[model samples]
Target: MGPIATTFPVLGVAAWSSTGKTTLLVELLPRLRAAGLEVGVIKHAHHDFDIDKPGKDSYRLREAGAAPTLVASARRYALMQETPNQDEPDLVHLLSLMEPHAPDLVIVEGFKQWPIAKLVLYRDDIGDPGILACENVQAVALKGAAPDTLEASIVRLDLDNIDAIAHWILQWCAAFPDHER
Candidate 1:
């Protein structure tokens, strides 16, 4: 595992595309927050994605060569940075960007090959090779019965049990140093 600055505890949910990663997060985030934890999220996208709409001022400003464009409003704000020719920043670099938010935990989505501890989500129909052999997989959240090949030492979780998963995440966060928490 590469050195990700341990400013905050980070737990990752890794899975192949269309394996319900985002769906699980949508359910899990609120529960984590309800438990009095401030959460930040970093998602890895396989293709170009735009949060700003065409003809929007922020989009226009970025197009006009603003390396990073910060747009703010009373309700919320966002910082969008352009990395024209640069390779995608690694997990450590991305985590550094969230330091200003000072969240208690950060849930990272995707970045399957990154060495951070992760809960590997699986479903039989995805046709992708299982990630159990991957380094740093701390647990597996399987849909339906636990696979016969699954290792007994690795924690097993039910993919459909959002409450249990959220509780497990909270417990995992507790294991991090109190200073980071």
Candidate 2:
């Protein structure tokens, strides 16, 4: 219900299937850490999931009508619950839970529909022009020439050049530290 205290700015990495988004995230995260920035990651799931199983005590407790049931141990914890509404929680709500140890940057691996600044992954192999239709993309990681119709704000880069991509993200982070706050 209140604002969460956080240090790292939030960013989104978006791309179509096989566009190399995950590859980029894997490479960039450690590099960002090497630059002394603590990084947190959020991956959006497209399917139904169960972190708690039916036979588990936590699952039974929830079935018995516990709201927001939490099962914890020294090693890990799990909270299982259902929201009252059909709408999913937005980015802000999700990030608030990471507070008290918010990393220097939060890299979101999906949610391409949102307004946050993003690096759009593109591949000529995907053969789809969805990237051309995306709005608010801060840059493009692609294998070929970026379409002239693409927004002027989108900085284009060679997808194979991990160093260039990493440097571009760091620069973006430096320029928008306040966004992380």
lDDT string for model 2 (48-165, tens) is: 7778888888899888899999999999887766765747657776787666665777888887777677888887668576765665688888788776677776788889999898
Specify the highest-lDDT model's number: 1
Q: TM-score winner among the candidates?
A: 1
lDDT (CA) per prediction: 0.84, 0.77
Using Cα atoms with residue i matched to residue i, what is each candidate's TM-score against the true structure? 0.92, 0.81
Worst 10 residues of 1 by lDDT: 126-135
Task: Write down the RMSD of candidate 2 (Cα, Å).
Answer: 3.6
In model 2, the worst 10-residue window by lDDT is 1-10
